[model samples]
Structures are given as C-alpha cells and as structure tokens.
Target: MQLPGTTLLVIDDDAAIRERVANSLEESGFNVLQAGLAADGLALLGRQRPDLVLCDLQIADMSGFELLRQITELDPDMPVIVSSAAGSMGDVVEALRLGASDYLIKPADAPVIEHAVRRSLDRASLRLENQRIRERLERVNRELELHLKELKDDQAAGRQVQLNMLPASPWNSGEYRLEHRIIPSLYLSGDFVDYFRVSDTQLGFYLADVSGHGASSAFVTVLLKFMTTRLMYEQRKQDVAGPVAFKPSDVLGHINRSLIACKLGKHVTMLGGVIDEAAQTLTYSIGGHLPLPVLFAEGEARYLQGKGRPVGLFDDASYEDHTIDLPPRFSLTLCSDGVLDCLEGTTLREKEQRLPTRVAEAGGEMRRFMERLGLDPSRPMPDDISVLVLSRNPA
Candidate 1:
C-alpha cells in the first residue's frame, strides 16, 4: 500500500530514463520530482525533502555512490535507492554499505520498478519513525539525570545537619569520662546517643534506637534531641521537683507522655543512665532495649537488668530503676540490637550469650568490636548500631 503525503525524487543524467521513472512513480500515487544531474538532485532534495530518492550509479558528472554519501551527510536518515544497468555485485554491496536503502537494475519492468519504489518508501517511513523515537529517548535521559543530581545534593545537605546535632566527643570531668560511636547504615541513621553534665557531680547519658531506618528513623532522632535538651534546661531552672536528682525513670516517663500527647506514635527502645561520682552510684533505666548493659568490675563482666516497657507503647506505663555501685575502677557499656548479628545463634537467647565475650575483648576500642561483630558502617546494615562506653578513672 502506498502512504499519502510522500514525495519521490528521480535523478539520472539520461533525460528519457528520468521521465520514465517519474511518470511510473506519479502513476502509482506518489509526488515525483526529476533532476538531470547529482547537483540538481541535491538541490531538489533541499527544497522538497523527498521521502525517498532514486539515483543512477553512473551520472555524467558525479558517481551515484558519492552523491549518496553527500545526501546522507546533509540528512543522515534520508533513504536512497541506487540504480545501474551494470549490475556488479561489489557495486551493489558497496552502495548499500554506504547508506543506500536498496539497489535496482536499469531498463527495468513496471512491476520491478513499482515494487522497488514501494519498498524503499516503506523503509524511509520506518527510518523517520525510528529517528523520532531516538530523539525523544535522549531528551528523557537528560531530564532524569538532572533530577537525580538535585536529589543527591539535597540528601548531602540533610546528612550534614544530622551530623551537627551529635554531642562533642571525649566529654570529660572529675565525675566521669564518656565516649560514643554511631555508624549509620544509610545517609541518615535512626540511632542516637547524647551525654550532658546535669551538675558539677552528676553526668547524664542516653542511647536510643528508633523504630525503623532511613529518613523516618532520622526524623525521630531529631525529635529526641529537641525533647532531651528541653528537659535538661527545665531541670536546670528547677522547673520539676523530684525525690532523686536527675532520675532516669522520671525522664523516660516525661518523654513517653509527650510523644503520646503529640500523636507521633513512633516508638523507641532506649537505655539511659545518670552517673554520680560523689555518691559512687549509677542509676539507669531500660525501655525494651537489647544486648543489655555490661558492667566491667573486678575483672568480671555482669549484665544490668531492669523492667520497663518501650516508650510510645502506653501512656500510663511506669519504668523501674536499676542501681549498681560503681567500683573504684569500672567500665559501663551500652549497645543497640545490631550487635545481635555478630552472635552465633538460631534464637534470641543463644545470640544474647555472645555479647559478654565480645564486650570483654572490646577493651577501649569500641569500633573494632563493632567490626568484629560483622557490622559495616560504610555499607548499609540490616539495623542501626550505636554504642556508648563510660569509664571512671581510678581515684
């Protein structure tokens, strides 16, 4: 079938051959233009922008193969069919390789001429359609690249803000010396630990693991910083009266009530403690946290136990306090659930047993212990890993 709105250009130095080809193509329902030489044919192409071109291999002034190359340079996708009475196989192959759509023998019959013209026109139509599709794809690829770059820049800025919220390291005083390490599995982390001096003799520290990973978990940590800072400021101003100064249980209870009231609904498992060097005691509370605290004293490791529901679970829930006397020289370590992966076990109980040996050998290098536990901070982890180690210098 012939497609409408298609023009055919016939180029031949022989006047009779040009007239015959043009007449045959016009009779077959195609618009036809004639040119007697290659130069004239190029001019016709520029003006008509024909769908297909039929040119003789041997023109009086220019070779059809050279003319085909020129035409392609002008419009790389335009289809051209080579015509010649001298049907050499090499010439046919070379013409096609040089971008000719097909080859035809001269003094041809009507059926042969019509069939070749129709097939060339169809080929030209397909070429034009393919060109259009490729152009569209290039445009889409450019747009997608731009969008990805913008998203990466925004995430980098957000990560910097998150890092700025962390407490300065090596927090030291006469009471205690504290150090913490947090390795996020992504651009942001849900695990956060903070330490602050509540008074000249009392130091408060807490580690919290929010319920998920990535941006949602990171948002929860941000909320924690705000709430914890506010609570510390209020206590300094004597805003709340209590039996024990800087009680871990009371702080957890307050935070729980605030989260419930605000409808944040996100829950966190936390372990928070207050160290009093003057009293020689450590008071702490646990909110469904994992791998419990290990107290290294007298060259023996012991786990601290407490009963408290996780925050955001219930509005009226109460947390219990766990107090242990600090030895003259002792170490306290708290960690998140990511440590469980390093444990060898088919069940939770079995994995919990591995914690003591790892912590005992960790000594003063917490980062080495985390790596030996099969946790990588550079690559994504299955869960967020956080640790806080507090060591009291011998009196």
Candidate 2:
C-alpha cells in the first residue's frame, strides 16, 4: 500500500533539477522535500524519516559523499538513489561504496527514477523478512531439543524403578539356591523372573518373555509378576492337601486367562515350576518357551521336555504339565531366546548344543556361564537377554 504521505527527500543544488525530481515524486503519491544544499538536506533528514533519498553528486555546502555517509550512519536500512552526470562515473561508484542502494542518470526520466526507488525498498523488505524467518527456525530447533531431553530423563527414571522391583540374585536357603540376571536392549525389559517359597518344602519359580519390546511389553511383565504372586498367596491360605494350587499347568492357565482379559494384545512364552525337594520332583509347564529349561548335574546337561501354546493367545488354550524327579543335586538354567541370537551357529541344533554344554561347564554359576558366552551387561544388546538359575551347591 503506497500512501500519499510516503516521503522522499531530494538534495540537488541545481534549482531546475531539484524541482523536476521533487515534482515527479509528488505525482507518484510521495510527500516531496527539496533541499539545494547538503546542510539543508541533512537538517531535513533529521527532521523527517523519509523512506528514500535522491542526491545529486555535485551538491553544495557539503560533498554528496559526506551526505551519503551521514545518511548511512543515521539509518543504514534506508534506501538511497544517487543521480549523476556522464563525467561523475567515478563519484557515482564511490557513492555506491558509501552505501547508495541504486544510481540514476543525470537527465533521469520520471518513470525510471520512480522504478529504482521502489525496487530498492522491495530489496530492503525482503532482507528483513528473511532475517525474521531464520531467527524463528532457530527458536523452534531449541525447543525440540529441550523436549527430547525431558523424554530421555523420564525413561531413565522408569528403568531404575523396574530394576528395583526385580528379585535379588544368587539367593540361597537350606539346600536351594535361586538367582537371575537380565540385560535389556532398551531402558526397560520385557523379560522377567521370580522365585519364592510356595510351601514348607515347595519352591516356585518362573521365567517369562513378553511379546514386543519397551514400555508395552514391560507392562505385561509387571502383570505376570502380580498375577503369580497373588495366586501363590491365595493358594497358601487354602488346604495343603488340596491339589497343589500353583502346579505349573494351573499357573499357566490362570496367566493365560488374565492376560486375555486385560486385552493388551500381547502374549508371553514362559516356564513355570514347583520343586518338591521332599519328593525330589520338579513339576513344570511350558507356554511356547524356547531353548527349553536345561538341567545340568554331575557331569551332564540336557533340555527339559515340556510343550504348550504361548499364554494370552487363545481363550481355550490348554497347557500339559510335566514332572521330572530331580536328582539330589542339579542346576536348572532358564534362558530367554534372545541369548540364542548371540551364538555363532548356522543352525538351531548347533546353538542348542552350545547352551547345555556351556551350562555343565559353568557348574550352575550364572557369572561363569555369562563369561563363557562373552556377554557384557553394560553394553546395549540386540534384544533383551535373561538367565535364571536354580541350583543346589555341592556339600
């Protein structure tokens, strides 16, 4: 919007040239200010902040070069057009170096002079707009960085809380030992384990790997712990003669129903068990758990036999319970499938061969087994890796 009050100050000592330029500018809707001397022009500039200026190179009192310099110091962004004659080429170039935005020929046409003024003002407006956009982009980038840092900090705090909820490792009592170690690929793990006494002579333990990873899968692990802990508590309150309540199959069925009810769209592969030290028996169930549980004793190790569909998949899915008479002294090792990916094997059979042999060599110690596999807890893993070991130390 070019308003009538838009001002242009013309400083040309020639009476005729100054009046002609001022008349052309006034016709173009600009308020015109005429000055025949540099001092008068400088005074007008201080009195009025014109949008542009037209200066003749040979103005009197002060040189046009001096006036250009003073104009730049007053307002560097203001556009300036210098009018010069043929012999003043050198002075015109020097004026440009002194900050004139454009140049006009001495006998300048009205149209051309008006065009130069408008073009210079447009360039100045574009520069200001570009600077504003760059500053705005920088501010947005800084805000995004701050938001990302907050999310990372929250995840770290959540990871620590999950770790604190896990049962302590290398736990020992009477003739039984139970312990576990887990390394998560992310801040939180989908793998979980628990071991606790279910009766005077019965010890219960289980290892589970929830589907998926991170927060959603970790939520299922918490559910697994809660359901199992509650089942054990309720069972202990009932008659001991009643069919052992936490039998492997019953535990799997209960978990299957609860997870399906929760509608989390997630499933779990697990090995749940009850060890009867008095009867020398280990009754267990498997819900699609892999690499099966391996039993190592004396000088040998082999995978336990058990089978069933993964829990939380189907409402009618049933588990077949299996029982083995445990030797007087044995080490049972449970591993999540993530560990198999770390083995340097071309076939599943070869990786399976590595697991038991390594267990027998470690003599049921979690540390020794992990060391043999070159596992580092501090380093990030491709997937979550977990190990649960139940052993009876040699007397």
Candidate 3:
C-alpha cells in the first residue's frame, strides 16, 4: 500500500511525460528512475531492481509491448504498466497479453496513477520476498549438512584414539599368558584392559569399565591408563631396585584414594592382579566387579574371591587381597557385566557358572567363548564388554 523505498522505472519518448511521472512518484515516497527510450528502460531494469515499470507505447527504438515482453522474460513476477496517447482498445489488449499489469491513457490523474503503481508494486514485493525466503532455506540446509559432517569426523577421531591406548598384543611372562578382549557399544568405549611388566618375574594387569560411553567414557579410560601405567612403573622400580615388594591390597587402596582425589562423578568397576612367576602365585583384588574370575586346574573350575568397593566411590574404603598358588597348566578368566547379558537366564551368578564349562571345553579360546555366549562382535553392544584370560603353562 505504502510505496516508501519502492523503486519505479518510467520509460517514455516524450521527455516531459517521463519527467512529470517521475516527479509525482518521487513526491509520493517512491524511488523513481527515468529513461527516454525503450532500450534505455530495459537496460536500467536489468541493472537496477525496480518494484514497478511504467512505459509509453510508442518509443524511438521499440514499442511498450516489446519492452514488457523482455521484462517478463527477465523476471516474470516484475509488474509493468503501459501508457499511450492513442488510447486504442487493440493496443491495450496487446499490452495486457504481453504481461503489462495495467494500460493507462495519456495525462491520467495523479491519484489514479498512484493507485495503479501501488497495486503493481505490492505484487512485485511479494515475489521478491518469496525469492529471498527460498534462498535462506537453501543456505540453512547447507549449514546443517556441514555440521553433520563435522560430528562424524569427531566420532572417528575418538575411536582411533581409544583404540591406540589398548595393548597391541597379548602378554606372556613364562609363568603366565594374559589375553584380553573388548567390545564397545559405540565408536568410543567405556571398557578397557591394561597389562604392564612390573619385573621379569612379576606382571600386573587390570580390566576396568567406566560409567558411560562416547567422549566422557573415553576421557575416563585415558585417565585410568595413565594412572595404572604410572603405578606399575613405580611399583616395579620400588621392588626391583629395592628390598620391598608392593602388595595388591596396598595398590588397590592407593588407586582408590587417587581416584577419589580426582573427584570425577563416575566410578570404575575393576579387577586387578599381580602375578609372581617365581612364587607361582597371583595376588588380586576386586572393586565391585561382576562375574568373579573362573580358575581352571585339574580339568575342573572354581571362583576366586576378593573384597573391595568400586574405585572413586569412597576415600577410606579398605581392600582385602586374595592369594592363589598357580597349578600347572591352570587358567583364570575375568569379564565385565556384559557377559551376563549374553546369558539367557536371569541372574549374573547363574550365567557365570556356565562360563567355566564353556572355557574348559573350548580349550581356553577367548573368542570362541564369547561366540558361545552369543555375543556378536559385529553388532553394537548395549554396554561395554571386556574379558581378560590368564593361564600358566605346565612346567
């Protein structure tokens, strides 16, 4: 309705008519541009975006109908009004067919001209607004696509980092063979296993499960690796270079205190052990871990017991170490809670009882055991699953 900032182009061979129309439209708040020929008007239309165009029928180079056809070709939605002194009905009909919005006679009143200009300008404004909206939507779609690509890249990087932190191969210490398996539910895992040589005769290992998945779990696992690696190095130097040997209970207690000091909201469920080849023994502790390890000897299986709370839970929690003398060609297997999910039955203890039988028959093949448990490594697990199998070859 209001033409403020609405641009209008006036084209007429008669300089006086063009000036009169431009002046009136400019005074009425429209931004008016004028041209004396049809060619000049079309050139201006291509260069400057105008809301409406008013053209005289007869021009030196071309007719108003020809200019209207060109304008429609360039932008069909742009409005055009035709004016002429001839006032012939045939010319008016031809102008309308050529896409002119209205036909006006020479010396038309200011009010009538203004009303026609306003209506035509309104149509042009609607067209331009719709065009702008379409462009904005296209830009938004492209941005969303880029954001999704970034997220996928981040996930891949996290998975690579997490995998690099794990042990590349199984550990063998003459008296013990340690093999571990882990399956993550996502690109990053919450489950982790660690092995480090404390001495030529002693080795330390642990399997831990953090609280959640993705970056949070990956971060926690990284911290665990650093702490455990450092602890093993320190303990080895303390024992090999000195007279005293570090006990499993003391190690567990120290880890618990350090985790509480970190003050991370999540806690870790873990089983840790120290194997001494010379003594043919293992000293171990459990921090609220599920499925107590299955010990195999003499072609039979049994469960070893340990006492402790999950790490990061309490600062003063005491741990009790359990000692086991290794028998010739014996095996011990430790697993996370996901093992229980593999069972068809209701309770974890019930499922654990069957694990030893499965391992004994499979000759302690960790992968076979997992398969027999109905775990599909190809599919995403509901929770992190880690398995650590340790065995002593017969002397």
Candidate 4:
C-alpha cells in the first residue's frame, strides 16, 4: 500500500522512459518530481528532500555515478534506485557500491518498479530507526556512569568517618600494655572495641562483634558504642550508696536490654573486662563470644572457659563475670570469629585447638601473631577481623 505524500524523484534524460516511470509511480500513489539534467535533479533534491530517488545509471548530462554520489553527499540516508540495461550488470553493481539502493532493468514493468521502490524504502526506515535507538542507549549509559561516580565518592566520605570512630591503640604503662586493631569487610565495620581507665588501679575494656557485615551491622556497632559510653557515664553519676558500678556483667546486661528495646533485629556476641593492677586480677564477662579469650603465662596458653547468652536475643538474658589471677608474665588475647578462616585445619576442632598454641608462640606480640597467620593489613579480608591484646613484659 502507498503511504500518503510519499515523494519519489525520477531523473532520466530519455523523455519516454522518464514519462513512463513518472506515470507508473504517480498512479501507485506517489508525489512524483522529474529532472532531466544532473543540475536540475540536484536543484529539485535540495528543495524537495524527497523520500526516494530514481535515475538512469547511463545519462548524457553527467556520469550516473557522480549524480548518485552527489545525492548521497546531500542526504546519506535517502534511498536511490538506479535504472540499468540488461547487458550492464557491471554498471549495476558499480552503482550499487556507490550507494544506489536497488537496480531496475531498462524495460521495467510497473509491478517490478513499485516492488523495488517499496522494499528499499522499508529497509531505509528500519536502519534509521535502529540508529535512533542506539543514540538513545549511548545517552543513557553516560548518565548512569555519572551517577555511579557520585555514589563512590559518598562511600569514600563515609569510610573516613568510620575510621575516625576507632579508639587510639597501644595504651601503655610500665606493668601492662594494651593494643587492638580492626579490618572491615567493607567501608564500615560491625566489630567495635573500647578501653579506658575506670578507677585509679582498674582498667575497663570490651570488644563487641555484632552479627553480619556491612552498613546494617555497622549501625548496630555504633549503637553499642553509644550504649557502653552512656552506661559508664551513668555509673559515674550515680550516688556512692546506690549501686556497684564498672562491673563487666552489669555492663553487658545494660547493653542487652538497650538493644532489645530498639528493635533493630540485630544481635551481638561480646566480651567485657576490668583489669586491676593493684589486685593483680582480670574480671571479665562473656555474652556468647567465641574463639574465646586466651590467657598466656606460666609456660602455657589456653582459652578462658566461660559462656552466656548472646546480647539482643531476649528480654531476660544474663551474663556471668569470671575472674583470673594475673600470672607474673602473662598476655590476654581476644579475637572475633573472623580469625577462624586464617587457621589451616581440616575441621573446626583442629582449628580451635591450634589457637591457644599460636597465641603462646606469638608471645604477646601482635606483629608476630599476624606474620605467623599471613594476615596482611593492606589486603582486603573476607569478613570483619578484630583483635585486642593486653600483656606484661617487653620481650
């Protein structure tokens, strides 16, 4: 079927052939324009910008190839059908190479002419539409790249803030030294630790491993930090007659209650402790934390035996405090579950059994422990890894 106002430009020097072509196309419902000379054809093309062109491949005014080339220079997408004699197969192919859409034999019937023109028009329409789609895709890809860059920048800024929240390391005195480190699986961490002096001869510390990794878990760690500090401050403000303060079990109890009330649907395993220099004792509480704390002294290293319900699990959960007499030359090492991946063992039992020996061999030095385990601080880890250690003696 013929489309409304579809224009066809017929350029042939032979008056009879030109008239026949024009009459056939016009009858087939086209707006037909005729030009005998090359210059006249170009003038009509420049003015009309027709949908298709038909011209002789052997014309007297100019080479048919030159005219075809000129039409392409004017509008590369305009479909052109070249008229050729039956003996001029070479000329037909050459014309096609020069951008002619199709070739019609010299003695073309009306049906053959119409079919060739319609087929070329359909192909040209599809090509132009596909080009439009490709252009739109490139534009959308550029916009998406820009948005991804902005998101990366925002993550970088958030990472710096998380780093600043960590406590300064290597708290030292002549009798004891405390140090800790954390490497997060992502830009933020779910593992958190804090150490401070609670009284003249007592040092307080805790390491909390919130379940999971990344931003959601990181939010819970921040909340844990706030609750710990707030509880400690509350104890300082309480009147002397009111209650005993700075107790490890009471602190974990407060944290468990606070997390339950917030309804974040997150839980944590933690170890909290208070070290007394004058009494030579370490009093600590456990809230389901595992690969438990190791005590190294007197020629042996072993995990401290303790158990309690994990914080944020239930309203009635509780933790128990355990105390150990500090050996003359001893080191206390605490680690989160992420450390389990570093051990070389066929089973978890083998790995758990190797831990105490490794701590004893490291001899209270973090660098030695890391080197032995092949843990490189610069490399990204699979999970959040954290460690806290306190020991006496320099060697």
**Which lDDT tens digits does candidate 1 get at residues 1-395?**
46678788889999998898888778888888899999999999998898888899999878888999999898887888888999999999999899998888888876798898787777777877898999999899898889878877876776787788888776777746788877787778889999887777778899999888877778888888898888878777783433226789888888788777878658889989988767888899988888788887666666888868888779778987888888888778888887676688999988887787677777634666666577666766767778888888755
TM-score, structure 1 vs. true: 0.82
For model 4, the local distance difference test gives 0.86
lDDT of 2 by residue, 1-395 (tens): 35666788899999998898888878888888988898888889988988889898777787778889999999898889988786467876898899999988879898898899888878877877887898998898899889878877877876787777688787886798998989999888999998887877788899999999898898888888889988887887785664356788999999999999999999999998998877879999999999899999878988998789999998999998899998878899999998898776999888988888888888878889998788899989999999999998658
Where's the lowest-lDDT run of ten residues in candidate 4?
236-245
Please give the CA lDDT of all the candidate structures.
0.82, 0.87, 0.81, 0.86
Query: Best TM-score goes to which candidate?
Result: 1
Ordered by TM-score, highest first, the candidates read 1, 4, 2, 3
**Which pairs clash in model 3?**
none
TM-score of 4: 0.79
Stronger candidate by TM-score (1 vs 2):
1
Clashes of 4: 0
| Model 3 lDDT-worst window of ten | 238-247
Off by over 4 Å in 2: 1-133, 240-244, 347-349
Q: How close is candidate 3 to the true structure, as a TM-score?
A: 0.72
Task: Tell me the TM-score of each prediction against the true structure.
Answer: 0.82, 0.76, 0.72, 0.79
Q: After superposition, which runs of candidate 4 have C-alpha atoms over 4 Å from their true positions? A: 1-63, 77-83, 86-133, 239-244, 260-265
